[model samples]
Target: MNRFGKGLLVAALVGVVGMAFRVSWNALRDVATATGADETAAFLYPFVVDGLMALALVATLVLTGDARRFALRVLAAYTLASLVLNYVHGLVPQLHDEVVDWGRLADWDPANWALVLLATSLPVGSIYFGSDLVAKVLHHRPIETPTTTPNQDESAETYVNRSTADLGVSAPAPITPAPAAVALPAGPGVSLVKSTDRVPVGAVAAESTRPRRATGRVPEAARSSRPVRTAEELLIEARKVTADWSDRELTAEGIRKAVHTSPAKARVLRDTLRAERAAAREASKQAARAAGPGEAAA
Candidate 1:
């Protein structure tokens, strides 16, 4: 429906409900006053009765399954309660001036006692059943799970290691250098010998040949200083950091962290990498055109 149409409908609904409450309001108040309610209690009586009926009616529309059925029962009960109060109001023209005479049932007074109890107990029932209806509606409310922020250090590592693999570029894990060899003291019955040394014939006759020491040791690398890392090398490693990046934007700070380089050098490498990638993409498009339909397109 159009906005104006909805507004008109809503205004009409309000007017109708207002007029209904105005009419029922007097009858319910009379019932409350006749049932020995005080001034304040009698004034609020219509709202407690009619309000619960309206609330339950709306609850039936919102609620589902068993909850809907429960709301429907509440609506019916409150509706019946209102009907009884209005019936009592119709019978009694002078509510407080004269006591209601129940004809033959006057001695037992069960019907009058029941109507008074129902009228007075409505507020209590509204509090209980209204709260229950609200609880049922709340049960269907969608729960929002609070999200936590990622750890900064872990995020950086994730961007470097995992994001790189996603970007189709990855650097191998750093290789640990082999530990240096240690020299051991020569043991008893062990002898150091040259390849040229010969064993005597009597030595072969012994129960066991004496253990021989190493003729020579494996020589360690002469140069011990760390090798210098080139810009190209840092750019290659830094590819892992920027490759999986959605924006595909390279930053000097990110490059510096990835390859552990100076900020100035990182900036230089960043520009070089961007240019290289751009050129590579251009080459691919050109190659795709050249390849035509004969071979797999670039």
Candidate 2:
């Protein structure tokens, strides 16, 4: 509802509740007095009733989801209700036997004025309860921050060492360089052997010196295989070969050769080129019409 509508509703509720509390308080006080209750109990009866009303208001504020708005409404309603009840209590001769004229409030005893102040202050003091209720209603659970464990803080080397110890495995020894080889006396037709491999050095040297030849023919497997070409690459190559040729002179075979694509792709490229040319011609005609007769003639 709009703000005005909500305000009207709250005002109506406050009127109804205030009237109900007034009636109930009078009835309870009468019953307590008639039942031979002590003077102290009868005297404190109205305060008890007001306290219960305040408690109910606090509970309503606490339970509602929109506690903030409800708390404000409750405060306004309680203030209005308190003022109305206080005025009624002051005016009614049966309720307040002491006759203090409205214009003579300044002349009234300090104790009587103090009592009036306390009664009005009761509802205002409940403002704190409303605030507490709102806080409780709208409170949210705190988010937990992420924390690192001891293991996560350890270095890679430390982790590896710990793991090896747990598994009862020893780490491998560090690698050491071998001693330099001593030269032996050269014998006829003897070849030097390297420590890295068993293969003769002469064979590797011979392979490196051999000449390489280029073959124009593709391998049987490669010739049968079809390579993937993007639509952009095919269109680019098709445009290049067909740039100097008219739409009628362009052929699927020429496009396939220019882009090295399959027959099906070549046919698609041919159709695309025809569509593009048709579109261009249509655009030129539209531009000429828009330019008018004088511009066309020029």
Candidate 3:
């Protein structure tokens, strides 16, 4: 059986058991009331039924966790035994008073009898077939052995011998490194040819030891105020580009009218412009500083 079938089986059992509880409760309550018992005794029926339900629920969780045929069988047996004992306890002449009358054939109380029958029936039925039902749902099928012909052993040995001889199971040879080459970087006004072949470590080391070109081109000064762009300038430019309209107001048409240049060019121009302004400001400040305090006061 599959999960759906097993689940349906368990659900059916629960329904039957739950109906038994309802029957037991009503029967016990009516019997207790007829006997003029106290409120406590009358309440015992629901308490006992609910207690059994809680016990069943706990057992179900524990048994389902382990999920073995033996575990389920034991659980079913436990429920069966409890149901039988509870039924017998309720039905025993000593346990309940017998209402007797002379010269009368009496019916066994319908309510009490029905409850007793239901309680016994559900658990007994469950125990007899429940384990097998659960096993079918959960157990793996058995594997079968194949019947072999007489010549099978001889054929197998012959195949193994031929396979091993063809395989040539020997150790492999060690690997060797490739030879290296020398290369140079491109120099100004000289047509440069790019090397497709990789230069080796030994050749590279020899080239590094040789005299290098001393081209007299001065590098840009790091400390020079030469207009420089900062992150702040880039963000300011982005804001200015969007300043004319709200996000919603900037339709595709409005955006097309706003800027004709590509974003890349705009970014480069914004950075260069910011740097030039900074350099000019720095030059003016330096000039003012060179003039001295007396000149500034005048």
Candidate 4:
């Protein structure tokens, strides 16, 4: 509904509640007076009943679980009590003129005693019960539950495969390095071993010359960082690395890994090392052929 319609509805509700309260207030006052209240006491008695009803109604809306049910019970009891008093007021036209005579009912001892007790004690009851209910409701707390499931920990393999799938590439299988191939960051000075499997791209391995410590800490020397070596310096290191090689099948990839240089620079370094090895082999073969005649003559 629009604001104007809402405003009109609220105004209408206020008018209706006010009219209802005005009608019942006098009836409640008459019931108090008939139940043995003095003139001054009767005047303020309507608030005791009506005020508790209001509090109970509001509490019923605010509370939950057992507290809500208690509030509802309080509201229903006060509402019924108010209805009974209002009904009594309607039965006697003399009550409207403030000339109610309770002398006949007062002669019945038990009935009059109960009526007086109910009316006099309700204000004190309203004070304690109504205040306690409101306090309990105000202090109430609720446990909140999570609405969504939390994410689980991701494994390195799953992360790698997912990342590769996103890039539209096949996930590479794990491979062992070739016998002559060196691991990336080989400048750290690890022992080289012979293995027949090819090392796939972005793969690396490490083997220590010393046995691993069972204490689970890497040796201090193994934890050292790689020193910054230039291209020429790395080529010098690479020549020393390949000097004990069994064949001339050294790859640029392996050279780049061993020395931590660019692919282009590794290719140049590999070509230079291969040509040097080839020339040395040729000179050795020529020397062996030339010395064969001299050895035979001797």
Give the residue spans of candidate 3 off by over 4 A: 1-14, 26-37, 44-46, 61-298
TM-score ranking from best candidate downward = 4, 1, 2, 3
In terms of TM-score, which candidate is strongest? 4
**Model 2, span 1-298: residue lDDT tens:** 9999999999999899788767656643433343344567656655554654565466564564555456556556555645554454545444443333432223346844654454444434555654565465567334466586666767666668655555563434444545555688879987655566344344321122223355588777777566566998789878877888877677888778877788999999999998888999999999888889877689
- TM-scores of all models? 0.45, 0.27, 0.24, 0.47
For candidate 1, give the lDDT: 0.75
C-alpha local distance difference test of each model: 0.75, 0.61, 0.52, 0.76
Candidate 4 worst ten-residue window by lDDT: 204-213
Better candidate number, 3 or 4, judged by lDDT:
4
Ranking by lDDT: 4, 1, 2, 3
Write model 1 residue lDDT over 1-298, tens digit each, in one string: 9999999999999999999999899888767766667779878889999999889998988887888999999999999989877876776666645454422212347976677678768899999999999899888654466564568667778668654455463434444544544555879986555433544334322222333344466456754466778766777777876787543557777778877788899889888777878898999999988888667544
Number of clashing residue pairs, candidate 2 = 0
Per-residue alpha-carbon lDDT of candidate 3 for residues 1-298, written as tens digits (9 for 90 to 100) = 9999999999999899789777666555544434444567666744443444454444444443334445455556545644554555455544344352321112457754564455434434544544454554455344467677658977788678755654544433433444453465757875444353434434321123223455586566734664555656644654577655454554444433454445665655455445655697899999888888879689
- Span of 10 residues, lowest total lDDT, candidate 2: 203-212
Location of the lowest summed lDDT over 10 successive residues in candidate 1: 203-212
Top lDDT: which candidate number?
Answer: 4
Choose 1 or 4, whichever is better by TM-score: 4
Candidate 1: clashing pairs of residues: none
